[model samples]
Target: MRRLMSNNLILSLFSLKMFEIFGCIWRYIAFVSNQNTFLLLTILKNDFITKNFNYKISIKT
Candidate 1:
């Protein structure tokens, strides 16, 4: 039971991460066609935030 529970938890976490990645990719694609400086800046900001998030996760692990 414990093993199953852990597996399910891991699966859920993985799915959430996948969803976030897809969302970011979709946003980036949308931004690509925008051709606006502000939108590009916003995408860059998101990239910075993603880098920070990865750093925090690594530190926690």
Candidate 2:
């Protein structure tokens, strides 16, 4: 009975540790995804502004 209880306690602790690791990994992934999205948006905005500038010049010419 003592051995069984000890095994159960160890298993519970292991599971808890694994959950913590998974949570950390998930947070990291979310952060990277957000950063990537921000970068993509900045690039798109720059492209749009550049295009508008070109169009205005062409019209003036």
Candidate 3:
């Protein structure tokens, strides 16, 4: 009975460690995706600004 309890304890500990590692990986993926989205937004914003500037210059000319 003691051996069974010890085995269960070890298994639980292992599962807990796995859960923590998976959590860290999930957080990292979320952070990276957020950064990618931010970059895409900035690129789109820059393109829009350039387009507007060009249009204004063309109208002036």
TM-score of each: 0.51, 0.51, 0.52
lDDT of 1 by residue, 1-61 (tens): 7886686667657756865886687677776666585577567767866875785466446
Question: 17 in model 2: Cα distance from truth in Å?
Answer: 0.6
Angstrom error at residue 14, model 1: 0.5
Candidate 3: count of backbone clashes, pairs at least 3 residues apart or interchain: 0
Ten contiguous residues minimizing lDDT sum, candidate 3: 52-61
Q: For candidate 3, lDDT tens digit of each residue in 1-61?
A: 7886686667657756765665566566657788776566556655755765675466446
The alpha-carbon root-mean-square deviation between model 3 and the true structure, to one decimal in Å, is 24.4
Candidate closer to the true structure by lDDT (higher is better), 1 or 2: 1
Please, what is the whole-model Cα lDDT of each candidate in the order they appear? 0.68, 0.63, 0.63
Better of 1 and 3 by lDDT: 1
Instruction: Tell me which residue pairs clash in candidate 1.
Output: none
Stretches of model 3 off by over 4 angstroms after superposition = 34-61
Pairs clashing within candidate 3: none
RMSD of each: 5.9, 24.4, 24.4
